[model samples]
Target: MDSERDELLHTFVAEAHEILDEIERALLQLETGRDVYDVLQRVFRATHTLKGSAGSVGLGGLSDLGHAAEDVIEALCRGDLPLTTPVVSLLLETVDAARRLVAEVERGQVERSTSHQEVIARLQEARRGGPAEPQGAWATSARRATEDDAEGATSIKSIRVAVEKLDRMADLIGELTLGRNRIVRTLRAVRGEAGAALRDEMEEQDRLCRELEEAVRAARMVPVGPWFRHYERTVRDLAHAHGRLARLVVVHGDVEVDTAVVERFRDALTHLLRNAICHGIEAPEARRAAGKDPCGTITLHAAHERGGIALRISDDGAGMRRERIAARVRALGRHPAPDALPDHELFGLVFEPGFSTATESSHLAGRGMGMDVVRRRVESIQGTIRIESREGHGTSLLIQLPLTLATIEGLSVGIGDERYVIPLRAVLACCDLPRGSLAHGGAQGLMVRRGRALPCVRLRALFGLGGSPPPDERVVIVALDGFEAGLVVDSLDGEGRTVVKPLGQLFRRVPGISGSTILGDGSVAMILDVDALLGGVVRDAVPADALDERRSAPSAAGGSPG
Candidate 1:
């Protein structure tokens, strides 16, 4: 009995935290120029549900806070209280206190503290200042709407699965995917020697295995909407605190991505938003002087790309100045003026540890820590980040992430005796590298395909494998972070679903290689990090005109990416 009760308490804690996040998001929406009455209903239901759940679990402090919040929301909906900034601020603070209470419960510290009482008092003060509650036809309809909202929330069905269990399932599926690849390779090798019926059966089994692997990955996919919504309160509170009037607009909220990616990106996104408020968006008076709207806009957009999702956070305010950033770069003892460097490399300076241009430190940005952490977390998931800025215009940050981390569609290529896998999303095209195309003493070469010049890299020399280019070497074009390069390889080994396995600490620092994977032939293949490889070896060698042509070209093979 004790065990069962403990399980219930754990479940309640998780659910309560989720409910609190929803409440905070809804409260933030109230500050937007939308129909405040409608948002009040959502806040009311969320608070009421939280109240009931807390009471059921014997969390008296949380229940009391929720009850007070619910009363304030009801008064606002009934027109007894005005939806002023202070009311919204008070309610938001209450949500934060509730979140802390939930965290304490998770930590096995359930007793309420002084903060809970403080929140309850504020809630009461907000409600007491309101006029007498209305009781007429309007009250009747409001009551009915509230009841319907409560019913809808209660009727929604959900089940909780521990995140650790999900991770384990993903790991198991990864191993199974690897096994499936091995079976497919074995069957292909024996296809000519085996009987017709036997080959047919084997083919069917291969198809089923592929389907199962996809199903497993699909099961772990989650919409990024809830995570985006949770940031609404953060943006609202931070903007007000910084005296920068800003609005957070989210688009394509229904776009789905790997749950792991969403979880990993939460803190990075928070830091980015905070940075935007602190350094990107200017004060209201400054904006008006600059002939811009007084209220700045920060928009987050998520959408499907070729083989992954692209999340863009753009702000319409004072953009980053290249010269100023260059000055900071010099302070850090780095060479090449910021204007001399490409936009990608220049903006990436913000992600350097201990890189900041702020004159003073504050609760938000400064101390030069956020962007570097963002970059680390992003790369940890095998994702890429890029920034775009125009002075006095705006700044946009784009993060491209794969669908899932467990398995990826990869193309295998051979160079001499070793094999390598390049993610299909990064592989643009395959073309022949004609003989005697050497330039710059073979350090870097340009491949002219169909009147378009593409900067190319020789893999053999890059890895120091001590082998000359073969007569029939093929160049595999890969596109990453708006740059395109042709990778010289011996031959193509076709495409396969490559299951990713993490490398040890020793290999983790190795550049150009992301992780290792087992091939169908039981051989180990290195997974190429196309972005890192291109960033390291080709970005500087590639001319600006060639890359401009690459971007102008329509096909991904030309390195033009959405």
Candidate 2:
């Protein structure tokens, strides 16, 4: 039927785009990287695969382009054409044409887009000058056919599922989790024999519920490798444009994160990489004078840490000048004494809006932008980013992100009568705030625990709630990166799996609060933005009327979160 054909066409287009991205990365690698023969063979087979699939789908234009590209690859493998800059550039342009053809197919025009004659003509012209194809040239290292096992059918390790379907599954599982929490809470009050029996069975049900929730979230997790690899061409092109040669090195890239994380952080990561290339890396002459490698290195590393994923993008470049950044902050009147601030806080100033240390703006960077967008994007994902730099050495921006935004291990704490959920991952320790132990530091206070001092922010005062500090005030130590801060609260209610629901546009810009969740007693609990709270972005005073929606416990918290 037409429906089946359309579906198959859609699948082919999706896969073809992925193939194009891989070809671009391999082509870039061919110029500067090792293993040229292997890379050439891979390119040859990918082109063949593209051609076969495009033909099967009735995409004659894409198939033709693929065939043309295959000829160029064959010439390379035959040693008839050299792998020079121009060759790589021409092949990359061919990829661009193929991508346009794929887009045309995606738009329901499979038979034609444009002729794609310009690039194809260039390809043929380049081939005319090469030596004639030698006899049996493919024998030395043959391009692979689509490999098959004992059976002719290829075994599929994965299948494409619609993201909408996965999202709905997550929504249903979240409700189940909330229902499980309600059951656990209701069972706690029962103490009689029959009640005890029911509670024992409920415990087993709870275990099953947890397993189901975890399974759904795990299904949403995707390996971070391809997502990072997508930016290789960006780095390569940017480095070449600025006359600063740089290479991206990926380490432990197989670490998996939720697909939602990649969706939200893609633009943020791109901006960060742009900043690294445009501002961080130095010209080859300057690098040689500094006794460093002529080609700068940008390293990307990902790993699971602090109950979440930590993505580090670092570069061996000119690095950040702390003194210059501090002087600029003071000159801008953002901080009067930037020198007294810690390195993390000082470095964080670069993310302030329109804050740039560069004297002039250019096409790529130094327009007093980007870093602020990085901060906002990271916060929007309920993640944190910090900078570490040594002058004349290098700079690294480390981002910490939750495994899944749907739910979290949350510790409930009371401020007045209102409850809040501090993501348990960000909560280091909870203790009573001993009387007079908080030393005053301007508007904020500092808590000294075990000889280590941490800045403190009281939720009561920050939220504009009218309340006096109780004799037994509590402090929750929440930290990101190497910086620590104490969140002053009233009481600890316990811990559990808290399902997150976004607060609509009304409170979207509210500092120190990420989202909301339902707690056991059928009360609304605001999820604390540990990143915001720890980073010292305290609100002067949130209006009392504006906070009634958050502070007042909703009469029906058991209802579905919208």
Candidate 3:
């Protein structure tokens, strides 16, 4: 009985948080003066349901507070109160309070941690004394029938599965994939009639496994829209606090991605967006002086691209200045003349450790911002991030991420005796580069491909594998974002469908390797981190993760194929 009751509380907490997200979004919408009547109604229904749900679960304090907040919204709906900035702000604050209460519930605590007396008292006062405003469309919409808010009714085609259960299922599928690989490998040796029959049966089984893998991946996916919508409040508050008018425009966020990926990037994107608001945006007077709109704009866009997801965050504010960056670089005593590096590489320096243009620190952001952390997170998921900035125009960051981290389509290649999987999407073309044609002293080497010189690195030399290379070396030309590079290997071993698995602690810290995958022959191969591989070639010069060694650089493989 206690187990069932605990489960109910968990469900309630989850539902409450989602409702609070909706309420917070509605409050932001209210601030914009759009569909006041309908917005209030939706929030009213949500709040009423929350109050009733809390009461049913014996959280009286939360229920009472919700009642007070409900009274104020009800007043606004009836034209007894106005839909002004104060009301919306107060309601948003109330939403925060409710979030805290729900958190306590999530912690398996029946006892409330907060009375929220101050917020509740102010809400009641607003309900009683706030002056009525012109009815407008509110009065007419208020007359329309709305079902009792206390009732929780829903029609949905879904089942609630614990996240752990889903993860376990995914793990099992991964194991099954490994087994399938082993069996398929064995079948390749057979050549008689019985072997042909076994091959046909194996094909059927492979089809089933692919379908199951896709189903599981689909189950783990969540739409990026709701997650993206939550940031509207963040942008609004940040802009207001800084005394600027900034709008967050989210486009095509309806694209779905792995739920884990969504949660992982939450803080990374927040740090990026916060920087956009605080530092990237220009104040109203300055904007007018620059002959631009007083209100700056921030755009968050997501879409499917190149067999993966591409997310771009851009701002119409004073873009980064190359001169200022160069000056800062010189001040830091960097050996490279800033002019020697290309514009892209120069802009990337801003992500280096302790790199910031802010003159002072604030409670929100300053000194040691998480741009490096952001890059690590992106690269950890086998994704790539690139920065684009224009003087006095704007700056944009584009990030590319694979759809599901559990599996990958990769080109299996050989360096000496070792096999490494280069992400298939990263591959542009594969060709031969003779060993005698290259001259190199440092780790950085250059190769001419398609009549253009591009940075090239030898895998065996880079990873320190002990073996003599083939005279005719092959190069898998890959691109991440706009930067292109070449990885020289002994041979191209064709394409593969590999299931990603974690590596031990030793390999996890390795810079160039991302994760490991088991081949049909049961030999483990390292998955190369194309972005990290380019880290040296790109000449981060000073990496943001140089000091701390980003723990989130994903997994690494140990021991080469014998």
Candidate 4:
């Protein structure tokens, strides 16, 4: 009976942490015009559950703290006290204390420590009209108490799963697919009229097996909302620390993404939201002086766009200061002409390593590691980030990423005998090009389409195919960072979603290749890094007129390539 009770307590602790995360997110949203009743009700419910479960398990210390926290939430729900900054801060502190108490209970050691008493006092104080006690002292004591209480009792339910599990599952699925392929091949080779019925049965088995595999994959997906909630608290705390009345608004909170992608994107989203609060939103007084609302708004919205997930973080505060960025770039000996640089390029400078707009270091984000880390992490997942800023209006960051990390739709292209896959989402259009129009030089030329000049790169030359360009070669126009460019290839295969597998360590530094995917025919296709490829074209100083002429010329092979 004791063992069963302990197991139940462990489950409570794990579930309580999940609930606490949701409550913290709600409180953050409450700071930004959310209904007080709704937020308080959620906070109360989480605390109530903790209190009930802890008491049932004879955890007096946890039960006491949980009840106190619940009391404060109930009062806030009743409108007994306004949800002021100090109150919200104290509530956040109380949530932390409760979390520690739950951890102590999970360890089977309940400490009647001073930190727990302080949390009770603060909760009661908020019930009255007193300001919260210093949070720093409470934080230190809570950590120490949790450390002291570490024991044989651990919540194993919270154990981290290895990424290799997902990898192994994917590999197993691949093998199963190969098995199905072999069965089909055998069915086709069977030599009798009686084998026809057997082949039909094999086809039915294949369909059910494929459906089962897809269902299992779908079960692994977790909603991204829980991960998205953490950013709300981060934004709230950063805004308060900086004396800015910044409100974070989130959209598509219910969107489901793969668990691996969610885990990978969590830090990137944190850095982006922190940057929006610390660098984008100005102080209330400054906002008033600038003739804008004193309470700044930072909106974080996510949705599906063009077969990918688009997340945009926008702030209605002071926008990017190009002159300051240009000055920094000049100091680094990169460029000195701020006025000559485009707005998008100037805003992109923030992502450069060791670059920051902050005049001095702060606890928030002045160390210059924020945007650079964001860029690297996003790139690690084969995603792209873009920035748009107006001088005085505001700044917005647009991040476009595939829906899944495991598989992506790709357009297969042949460069010599080597095959490469361009993410179909990245390919704007494909057309055949005349051999006479493509200029041959170190720098690829541009093509003009719809009155816009688009750069053109011969895929054969770029990949060093070491053969003459095909007379009926195709040009795949890809759009990246607001620029369109074309890659000349020998042929275009059909588009399909292929599971992308990472290349070996030797190919890690290979230019213009993000990863590789295996096709239905069991052939390996290299996935092109459209950003890197187009960036290469721009860096080579390709002439604009040549790009214009290539785009205007009719394809010698008649219609669109794919």
Candidate 5:
């Protein structure tokens, strides 16, 4: 019985950690966005989960803390106590206590410390605005009512499993690689007309394998909307602390992303939003001086862009000061001639390690690691980051990320025997390029289109596939950040959604390819990084005339006035 109890306790601890993450994410979301109803539901669920699990494990102190948190969340849901700073602070402290308790449980001990009681008392006071009434008739009646409410319970239906179990399942599925190889060999060995039937069966198996992989990946996803709330609170406090009136505006809240990615990007997003409030926005007085509205506006918007999620953080504060950044760059001995640097390059300096434009370190800015860390975290997920700033107008950060780390929609292209996957989101269109239309030139290499000659890079040459350009090779036009380029492929196959898998460390440094995927035919197809491919082409050649003219010109009816 003791062994069984120990096993249950271990399961409780693991499940509690997952709930804590959800609670943290929900709190963050409440801070940034106005999804009070959804945030309250998630917070309540997490606390309720913890409370039940703690009680079952005989951790009375932990269960009591969970009960106190549950009460506060309930009150918040009922609109009894609004989500004020003091309330949010109390909730954050509650989360911290829950975390410490979980850790104690992991160590096979229970902490009977007064910290839990103190927090519970504070939360109760905050909720009631004073101490409880004496143990009179009214109090006894209220206690009896609460006890009756607690006793009207339902039977437990399900058990919470550790995420590690799912992870282990994924590993076991991954080890089916050897079986896949044997199946492939068997299919290839079938002769004559039997080969076609065998190939069909293999394709079916492949589809099932891909579906299984996607399901395993989906189990790991947690919604990102909850995490946006905490930033709302952060923005509010930072505004008050800095003597500025700032409002946080969230554009899209219903969108979801992988849980691990959300967890990884949480701090980076918070730091970015904090920087926007502190350095990106002007104070109320400064806004009035500039003839702008006195109340500063900071917008956090996310949407599906290309094949990935684009989160744009923009502020109507004073845009980046090139002169200040240039001075810092010189001070750091990196570049002395700031005058020659373009706006993009100048703004890029913010991500340079230990480089800060702020004269002094404040609580919010000038630690010098904010933007640098932001860049690292975004890039760690194979995402791209860019900044567009207009002096005196505002600064907008554009982050382009793949829709999912585990899967991608791909347009397969072939270079000789080698196949590559061009993310369908990145592929603008595929057009036939006649042999007569090819024009080779200076640094910009060959230009294919007519009006604005786009820099063209041969896919075969880029990937070192030994083949001459095909007579009827087509061009895959990909546009990124307003830059358009055409990739010349030997052959264009149709499109399909492909499950992307990481290439080992040996080939990680290889240019042009981001990752690899297995095709329906069981052939490995390399996934192309359109940005990198176009970047390399542009970097080696003279910049092509902006491709804006070639773009299907906007219709005049709903378009901006000429």
Candidate 6:
């Protein structure tokens, strides 16, 4: 009986949090002054349901808070109260309070507290059309929803599985993938020794294994709609607090991706949005002075691209200034000439620790911390972030991430004794790079490909594998976020349907390597970060001779394969 009751409590907590998320989003919509009536109705209904569920579970304190919040919305619906900023803000605060109560329920603790009483009192005041009284609960209720709840409701189409269980399932799928690769590789070598029947059975098993892996991956997929909606209130409140009129516009919210990928990107997305609002968007007066609309627009767009997902956060605000960043860079005493650096390098400084141009700190930004964290988080998921700005026009951040972290179709290539997997989406083609075709030295190298100068990175040299290059080295051309590069490899193995497992923390900071996958022979192969490597090659300077060689090769079929 106790076990059943505990299960019921868990369900209630999960449902309550979902309702609270809706309430918060509704409050944000109300702030926008669009669909006010519908939003208010939705908020009221969610709170009413939350009240009933909490009461049913004997979580009286949580129920009371919900009841108070619902009353305020009901008052608004009945024309007893106005939808003033204070009213909406108070309701938003109540949502925060309810979130805390639900968290307490999740932790199996008593929900009632002094802070809950204070929130109830303020909510009552707000409902009565009086100014919501400043209460002691304000400090305690000031909780930011930093992370997402892992639990989601079960439906007829789906069963509720614990997140840990899903994680374990993914791990098992990865191991299965590794084992299957081993079997296939071994079978291929001994095809003549094995009978036709045995070969056919192994082939059938491999097919089933692939199908099962895909099914598991699909099961872990989640739509970005709910996740995207959760940030509406955050942008609204933070924009208002900073006295900036800004709106968050989310597009293509139905894009599906791995739940783990979404969770991994949570903090990074939040930080980037916050940075856009705090630094990219300017005050109303400043915007007007720049001959732009007083109100700013921040867009969160997600879509499927190249078998992966692309998320873009853009703002029509005073775009970032390269000069200002260079000035900040100089203030840190880093180089002989800061302004002489290229725009990409200047922008790259934003992700460096203690890199900021803000003159002062605020509730939302400053302290130069968010961007660095954003960069680190994106890389952790084997993703890439690209920033584009037009000075007075605006700024756009494009982040490309895999749809699922579990498995990817990659081009497995060899570099001497080591192997690496390059994402198939990024791979353009493979070709032989004749000796001496690679121009320039040091960190920068270039080759000519079909009349265009292409940057190249030698994997053996990059990873310090320290071996003689093969007589016939191959180069795999890869394209990421409009940038193109060629990765010089020892040999081109065939296509790989590889499962990606994250490397340990000790290797987390290693450049150009994202994760590791177990190869067919039970050896681990590193997954290359083509985006980062290309960016690094761009950052380095190519010698004049290399440029001449690249220019001269345009008539020689440009060094690309036919």
| TM-score of model 1 (CA atoms) | 0.79
Considering every candidate listed, which one attains the maximal lDDT? 1
Backbone clash numbers for all candidates listed:
0, 0, 0, 5, 16, 0
Give each model a TM-score.
Answer: 0.79, 0.80, 0.80, 0.83, 0.66, 0.81
Question: Candidate 2 lDDT, tens digit per residue, 488-519?
Answer: 88888888887677888999888888899877
- The CA lDDT of each predicted structure is 0.76, 0.75, 0.74, 0.72, 0.69, 0.75
Once model 5 is optimally superposed onto the true structure by TM-score, how far is the C-alpha of residue 28 displaced, in angstroms? 9.8
Clashes of 3: 0
- Supply candidate 3's per-residue lDDT for 115: 58
The predicted structure with the larger TM-score, 1 or 6, is: 6
Residue pairs in clash, model 6: none
Model 6 C-alpha lDDT per residue in residues 49-157, reported as the tens digit of each score:
9999989988888888888888888889988888887777788777767777776766777564558888798888777667774543222222243233223212211
Of candidates 6 and 3, the better by lDDT: 6
Top candidate when judged by TM-score against the true structure: 4
RMSD of 4: 5.4
List residue ranges in candidate 3 displaced over 4 A.
1-15, 52-59, 77-82, 106-108, 128-171, 181-197, 284-295, 335-343, 391-393, 438-447, 480-483, 537-562
* Candidate 5 Cα misplacement greater than 4 A, ranges: 1-95, 112-207, 230-251, 281-299, 314-355, 387-396, 432-444, 536-538, 541-562
lDDT of 3: 0.74
Tens digit of lDDT per residue, candidate 5, span 373-394? 9987886666777888877888
Model 4, span 418-495: residue lDDT tens: 889998887878886745556653336655555555567787777766877655778888776656677878888878
List the lowest-lDDT window of 10 residues for candidate 5.
Answer: 150-159
In terms of lDDT, model 2 sits at 0.75
Candidate 1, residues 447-547: lDDT per residue as tens digits? 77766667788787777776666678888888766666888887889888877877899998888899988777667899998878887766665567767
